[model samples]
Target: MLGAFVDGELPASARETLEARLADDPRAAARVAAWRAQKAALRALCEGARVSGEDAAPDAGQAGAEPAVLILRPSGSWWWRAGMAAAWVAVGAGLAVAATMLVPRLAPGLAPELMAGAAPTAARSETSEAFARRADIAYAVYSPEQRHPVEVGAADEAHLVAWLSRRLGKPLSVPSLAEYGYTLVGGRLLPGNTGPAAQFMYENDAGERLTLYVASSAVDRDPVRLLRDGNRRTFYWSTERTGYALSGPQTEPKLREIALDVCGALGGKPGQW
Candidate 1:
């Protein structure tokens, strides 16, 4: 009995039964307590405080969620490992049952055409937030690094447009940023969690860089939305043909100014693109 418990070979139902029996049997309780203490001490020595109960609880009632399961593999000599295999199999079966009851929700729905999956509108909001966070990360990645700033620099105006147009599936042109004291730095193809996108970068003589990430709507979207978040500003709008997003650390007024110029230079329809 002591050996099975030490090896954690008892099934959960059997363990529960033994636990109750131990409460009534002082000798069994003493042995279990000693074993637990030794296990805790070993774990503490190996993993430090991180193995402590500091894990935050996951959110409830989310679809496509899966609970985490820990598997303990047999690690002794071949004979010992063979002896433990059956015990681990029982534990694995128990975990499979528990997982059916406690599946985790998917990561906030950043997939293309989620409406086809019939997800709720609320879930869509979470997806948008996730994208915004990703946009910030994209900005951070390209904002630095002077040498490899853009894939196609401003000097190759014709080439930049041709490449971006082929990648974005749209006719793209480098909007004149001279008025804003910025020139085209280059452009690149960025993959979003939901779909593919195109990012066109620009730079001013002061060396400030701005970027535009363009992708078509992954879901049915509103006509136009302008979001200014802290140092990052986003101008997002969906037309019949495509969706456009201009994001940067510029102010709302400045972002709008650049966006209008981009639209005009692209020959995009007036009002919004």
Candidate 2:
């Protein structure tokens, strides 16, 4: 019933009754909120990808340039929207796997260089940079949502962790940032460079949001690195198991501190350099 309300599929009379119930039932209200947030997150991800693809395509008027083709046939059909969403999920999974495969070929000397204490450089594989940039973009797109910032609220921490863990095929945990005055708002599953990714969001009392993006990667060990795109700052690193990127509009020092907390919570000890 709440799902139908969230999707706008409820009949007029049914919708009114649902709204009346939601007005009184806190649990139902929370479920409705989660559903709405999930829907908005999906729309944001799809639109961001669509806009990015369009921006990258060559102009149709350019000599020998082929026109970009985007299928916009979903219109208002729920089935078509669902199918398109599934297709996008598959595309993301495939891209992530392809990137994982290319990491070795693109940077054959990466492991040795890292072992020699060299940092990732301009010569690093495009896949690493893409993953970080995508994390930044996802943060920018979803963090500012007023009504629906997270697909699941922190109250459902166990289920959120379990669901994302299953999707990513790895054990997952959410770190506590209470020491920094930010509590977990919740998390959602996203597309990663080689497979499924998970994003956990935290919010401070001031309403500031920070996101931690976790994904599986071929590159196992990398130094803690800071990346800045526009006003956002990200501290990203990788372990033998997975890669992590924490992004927000916080100061460098603050983000670094939080990153260390995250690392400690995740069973790592990243040196401050």
Candidate 3:
């Protein structure tokens, strides 16, 4: 139940009930916090699949080390099973296999560059940086696709927004980019650091593409900033704990203009971000 709540998979009514309970019982809230941290650490290990030498996995042949090789038991779903297998295959006997033991030592003991990127209470700066990087990666991976770039097409805009809104636990508005020569191609659901994220893709007649990545966050309103990652450029900001990043191959000035437009179209106040 706590995991479901943290994931925003619980119904709103049940979530309210849980929140009330958590408010009355500090232990419940603590449990939720710890669960979210564990989820984040696991996600990091799976994505990075590497451990710093000092925090490396316990030796397999060392005495008393066998017990530390924790295997993730999947919860009887095809997706879970596949994820488990992928993590195992990716890390072998490395980070993914040892994240359970590795996470506890993360907070003040390791560098921020490690697999455990940040603590649960890390500043909005960290979150915004990660959000932009993820957006850059997402654009590089999916924007080049000639087929199936998005799970839902623009024709079903209502359904796409509704579906992504449910997953992110926040209502979303799909901004029109037609004025800028880019039309909404579609959008897709994505995995976020803490929960779920959504990405909306747009394309121009010249086949150039841009993507907007959005996710629920816990951040103060941050002004838009540009991040250049290789050939991709991203303009990212956060308002009321919701992070947004617009990424593409366009010129910095052009992309910045479009990002500001998206921020405005989504009802973000000019001073808010």
- Model 2 clashing residue pairs (backbone): 96-193, 96-194
Q: What TM-score does structure 1 among the candidates reach? A: 0.51
Better of 1 and 2 by lDDT: 2
lDDT of 1 by residue, 105-206 (tens): 343343333435566655533344455455556777887866676776768878877877787677765566787887778887788654566777877877
User: Which wins on TM-score, candidate 1 or candidate 2?
Assistant: 2
Which candidate wins on lDDT?
Answer: 3
lDDT of 2 by residue, 144-173 (tens): 977677888899999999999999998988
Residue 54 displacement in candidate 1 (angstroms): 29
Give RMSD (Å) of candidate 3 vs. truth.
20.2
Candidate 3's residue-wise lDDT over 152-239, tens digit each?
A: 9999999999999999998898899989999999999998877888999999999999999998767767789999988789999887
* Candidate 1: stretches off by over 4 Å: 1-133, 219-223, 264-273
Superposed Cα deviation of residue 114, candidate 3 (Å): 20
TM-score of every candidate relative to the true structure: 0.51, 0.55, 0.55
Give the range of the ten consecutive residues with the poorest summed lDDT in model 1: 57-66
